[model samples]
Target chain A: MVVKVYGPDYGSTKGVLLCLIEKEVEFETVHVDGFKGEHKQPEYLKMQPFGLFPVVQDGDYVLYESRAILRYFAEKYKNQGTDLLGKTVEDRGLVEQWLDVEAHNFTPPIYSLVKIYFASVLEGVPADPKAIKENEEKIEKYLDIYEKRLSQTKYLAGDFFSLADLNHLPFTSYLMNEMEKGFMVRERKHVSAWWDDISSRPSWKKVLQDYKNPYDVLKEMNLVN
Target chain B: MVVKVYGPDYGSTKGVLLCLIEKEVEFETVHVDGFKGEHKQPEYLKMQPFGLFPVVQDGDYVLYESRAILRYFAEKYKNQGTDLLGKTVEDRGLVEQWLDVEAHNFTPPIYSLVKIYFASVLEGVPADPKAIKENEEKIEKYLDIYEKRLSQTKYLAGDFFSLADLNHLPFTSYLMNEMEKGFMVRERKHVSAWWDDISSRPSWKKVLQDYKNPYDVLKEMNLVN
Candidate 1:
């Protein structure tokens, strides 16, 4: 059975779709437009109790949590060109390690920035400059680790392009856009180089082109440029 | 090779130890007393760049994240006892689901309480009543979901005792003591009942007995009594 993903365009769900594309796996995308509160609606919430976007249904199997979904897809579709999860026990552990870093260290600051600068506009809350500054500092501290690691390795998971790099594609994309407007990635040369490589991938390009702006309602609120 | 875990008697490391016990895995615990800043030492930092406790070294394999450690141990020691990760694809997905819920939903409020009520005393910061109350309300909202789920299933993974249930043990123990003082868990019937069952487990009992002082430290902070 084909996998069905419920997600918004240009969101974290885009990461999952990009993975599927890179794996060349056929799947169906069910766009749950966030502007309509579709994700929070009864149907979507029934599928994902937390009402988060990027819920995947593969046959009778249902899974959320983008990292887990990526891991699941990678393992299930191992015939795909890349063994992104890991080829060995140590590699798997390292992949898991980087994924944790992505979840615990990277995403928080990225989301913090998004919440203060972007989400406020999307959710109609006033943006807080103090929060944004705090978040920027936090992002810089976290990026230091990535910068150090990427300098030694070609990808997040050493020399190979693994799910760890793929998993971080969306956040890097968002971060790059933020950096162009004076965010800190450029100063972190290794991170900047890594981001440039992943952002330039064909799969990521497709994701960028295909993602629908579910938060367009925020435009009505003068949130997006 | 005997698995070696570098962890303190208290904190989230207790959950790791509990998982080891539940799996009937033979492991040696290297207690890094947090009071001395052992976790931040260069050697420990090499094992866990985050400077967090609960770093496991099984032979040449080393892993740091507590949840990831639990998954690794569960997968490696699958025949010892419980199938905590899950027996099937869907089961594993649900295991990941609850784990994420615990991490994303449950942990924030718990951490907030720890920061305001517990960590403040340890760090010599003044306790903020406003933050404590805010965190308490957040925990209450998230516990309602756990209440509903536990009312239906004997365990978090439905009918089987899984790592999901084991994962919550330490946090719940801390919360229960907190509830006894000012933090509230008694009002939620199902959550209270679920707590009673899991806390009564032998593995949890062993963890509580082993981490006596930190438990006292939590009580001294009035986070638990």
Candidate 2:
């Protein structure tokens, strides 16, 4: 049986879907519209207890967590193309390190930006300027590290465009295009160049097309910026 | 040359130290006393800019991040004993999944508990009662999951004890004994049993001894209940 991924079009899950598309791997997409409460239903909860998007099922094995799903797919379908985990033990460890950095260090600030700007505009809550500023400062510090790292290597993981780089595309793209008007990767030449390179990919274009405007759905609930 | 780990004796880095002990891998420890601001020093920051503990320098290869360090040691010292990453592709993926779960789901609640009751006290701030209550509730929810999983498998990765189980010990141990007043795992039969079994191992006992006054250190700060 082919692998099946259950998730929305855009959002963070788009990273995994984009990866699958990039590799041209055969899989089924089970759309669970987040705005419609389909993901919260009992049946879906069985697949993912957290009621989160991007749950992948391969035969009898089911797994959630977008990063894990991406890693699993890449390993399972190594023949599909690029090796995201890396070719050597040290390289793989470096890849894992950067992936963790993305999760622990990078994602928190991005989530803060989403919550303050996107969530408030959509959910009818007052966004805290202090929180947003704090998060931005954190993001800037990380961007400096990325800027330095990218200056040396073409991709986040050495020469190859591994999962480490691909995994970060969804959020960085959203930050640049939709989340905040002032957000710009162009300040960092290497990061900006890499962002443009990844964003221009055909698979990424498909992701942008699929992601529906969450703000529109929020408007229905009388939640507006 | 022996593996040299630069980290404080007790901190988040303890997880990597425990892994080294469990594998019976010989290594030298360099104390980066966090209280003295050692981690933030120029030399230490050069190795890990994040200023975190448990940075391992194995000869010429320098690596940070506790999970990555654990995996590297497991792979490099494969003959030390148990193959924590798994022998098969699916097994390794499952191990990665559980590790991700540890990073995302498990650690947050535990940290919440630590921050509310322990961190505030350690840093000499008043503990928030409401935050403690909320964290305890969250800890309970995750413990139920751990109980259920432990009931079926001897260890987190199955019959064989893997890195997944070892990776969790430091946080879970601190939560159960020092921070949560031993109430976190005591009520769950399977979890409690597993804790007793794992904690009693010679390797784990050595780890505990390495960190002096385990509870008293927190108690001195009035962080332990």
Candidate 2 positional error at A207, Å: 2.6
Give the clash count for model 1.
Answer: 1
Per-residue lDDT of B154-178 in model 2, one digit per residue for the tens? 8776777777778788888878776
Chain B TM-score against the true chain B, each candidate: 0.90, 0.90
lDDT per residue as tens, model 1, A1-225: 888988877667888898889888888888787767888888887787678878998877788887778877787777775678667656776777787778888878777776566555555688787887787787787788788889899987678888778878777666666434335778889988888888888888888776754344466556665
Candidate 1 lDDT, B97-192, residue by residue in tens: 788778777877776776565456566688888888888777777777677787888777677778888888777766777434324567777777
Clashing pairs in 1: B177-B224
Q: Candidate 1 docking category? A: acceptable
Q: What count of clashes does model 2 give?
A: 0
Candidate with the greatest DockQ versus the true structure? 2
DockQ of 1: 0.48
Give the runs in model 1 whose Cα sits over 4 Å from its true position.
A119-126, A178-183, A213-223, B123-126, B181-193, B218-225
